[model samples]
Target: MDRLKALAFTTSLLALVYFFTQTKFTLSSIQWPTSLFGGKQQPDFSMYKSLSTLSVQEFPLDPAQSRRTVIIGDIHGMNNSLSSLLDVLDYHPGSDVLIHVGDIIAKGPHEGSMTVLSYMASHNITGIRGNHDQKVIEWRGWLDWLHRFPDGRKWLTALERRWDEAAAGGADPGVWASKQMKRHRSPWWRTIPKDWKIFTEHYKIARAMSDAEYRYLLSLPLVLHIPHAHTFVVHAGLLSSDPRYKPRDPRQPLARVPTVFGSAKSKHGSDVPKLRRAQELALLSDIEQNTDPWVKLNMRGVLKNHDVTRGKDGRPWSDIWNRDMSRCGGFEHDLSFDDAHTTPNKHKMLPCHPSTVVYGHAASRGLDIKRWTVGLDAGCVYGRKLSGLVLGRHKHNDLKKHQSPTPTDIPFGDNFTGHVVDTECQLE
Candidate 1:
């Protein structure tokens, strides 16, 4: 009986060895069953990837175009407020170019994000990606990757099931996770934290998104340049220029100015002069290349040392930008021999053009309107006001006067005038 049992065990061991050797099974080789997850084929991961930095989109400056340019601030999923603000602007679809200043979706109502996204997509509106939008994109990307593997799908399903169970029991998922960690005493439990529920909404939003919506989010750039308006639209703020590199001659084309005179070709451009169009192209190229992607999305201050901070540690970047824009160009200032010696970097102290930057991430400041920078975020998600900067060719008299008390008329391009219009938001 013992010999027979040993034979059977040896046979089973041989069978197992044969199965592994013949099949060559591996985690990578396992195919996720499509039927398990809506029967949809795996999507091309690259199709939904977001650009890190230097993604720029420029609109042609048509002199004859009478369309108004409306730059709106952070919506933060306050779709009702957004709609009311547009109504207040008397927005005309064919005659107005709508540009959002990021944070269009997230944090307000449950359906507000998708509603705003759908509206923007249908209207052909464009804008930069906000920090919140980035988080949603990341979650979607993670979910997409996980859905490509059977085990990953199972894990996500289990998490969802657990979340549902916790919700049904009227228990906080974070608290429940803490208890599980204590009971299990396993390293895997550590992966689930007490604050995991904070990201649950983002995960839910990502999962509920359609392909078109996901694609739209992925298409958003870090910086949007409006050449004719002499404006840049970003989520947060931008530095004037890199302090490490000596300033260039504002009088000459950016491409012709060398980093260090006679050292080598300019990092910005070739030694040869570029045409007006080429120069325009080089402007954003230089700025986007020098600035980090994160800085463009969250910068609030620029330290004295030229370092940027997302916190309130230094001077507001807008103040620095306005300072740079207001300075006299090197050519405008004449220096004597003694003065030149005293200010060795005098020639490098050229001023930037009075270009405008419309940004929206700093809601705490609320409706910041500077000479060269406009901050339109008015904390709409916090039951404050939704703000917008409307630029139109109509004369001040011809433009429709909005009833909103927040409207402030301001000068725009050579032929355009702008107004800061806002409406009260419903408390979430």
Candidate 2:
């Protein structure tokens, strides 16, 4: 019996040695054994809400009453560039509303992110969460989780000290993380791929973040709906309709269309009612509830199968969005094979209102402006221009040349126009 016990102990020690020496392990590769429970696990979103709304009441759209709504694109911690851009715009505090389209931090100078976060917090600036922002949030959450345990607190303190040393020595965080992963031999690190090593910077930023900065990131939603501007601001593009719905013939008219403007007479010639506010909000909410949160943060295109993908191989979501927005009603007749094949619908397409989406995250395309959609990510981190879409009653004649004219089909009625403005950024 004593011999048997000794043999089992020897086998366990050998297994541990094999795992530590032969395997490429890291702390991040740990996974919960949910598969053993025999059911798929749903993502926990209790910590954050997916959607938020902003109205003209909070941010007045009138130029006489307020300056303008300056919606900036993927900042990527270019604080200096951001200041310069604001200077060029002649931004007025308490008068003008500033909104970031996300990717606010990461991929730039470390101090720049903290500076940007401090500035945003002080100024009450609000925006949607980007993919990079999400990564930082996850890291911060992990750090918070670790802080609850005695050993974890020690482990984190050591990790932070090591990071500080790496920074002081001018070592790249990605290189440092790679070395640390190998040295630590934690099973979690083995699951990470080489390309994802860039996330090491994200981890560093997360750990360095102040409580205020972390809360600011946590407060941001995946989508921000502005009722008065008839615009939806999101980190990435939004689908025109539910992907599950079948495609309708663009040529067909709706069975029942909502009235956009009321005919009530006002002091000014006629009273143009709110722009289908209810329908637009419902549409926004529907998309938010149905689509995966990750899709809102990373999607660039939609596949023919109606699945949203981060890859550029699929059809540009903006194109489909513009096509769908141009039409106000649903199809009356059954869709033909040609119609179905040409459109991005696996199920029936419903009526759509002429709503606009102001988004970032697609820096590769850079400064996409359409009648119904505006993509403001101009790759500022890559030394390209940092873009902003200014929407208000005030018109900048200089920016007119850059602005896409509102489509004749849509009735915006001169309440506001979206003008694209940008400034050059320095290479990080």
Which candidate ranks first by TM-score, i.e. highest? 1
lDDT of 1 by residue, 328-377 (tens): 34223422222445666665444223467889999888989888789999
lDDT of 2 by residue, 1-428 (tens): 99999999999999999888656465324333232233654223225557888977655667565457778999999999898777767677666788999899988888898788788866668798999888888777766754654554665577667778778888887778878877876443432333554337687688788888888888999888777667788988777666555335232222123344444312222222342564565465456423577777888998888778899789888997777676543222223322545656533444434678889999889988887788899999999988876666455642334432332122231246556668889975
List lDDT for all candidates, in order: 0.66, 0.69
Model 2, CA-based lDDT: 0.69
Per-candidate clashes, comma-separated? 0, 8
Instruction: Tell me the lDDT of candidate 1.
Output: 0.66
Instruction: After superposing candidate 2 on the true structure, give the runs of residues whose Cα lies further than 4 Å from its correct spot.
Output: 1-46, 162-199, 249-275, 285-290, 329-350, 397-415
Measured against the true structure, the TM-scores of the candidates, in listed sequence, are: 0.74, 0.72
Candidate 1: worst-modelled 10 consecutive residues by lDDT: 48-57
Q: By lDDT, who's the top model here?
A: 2
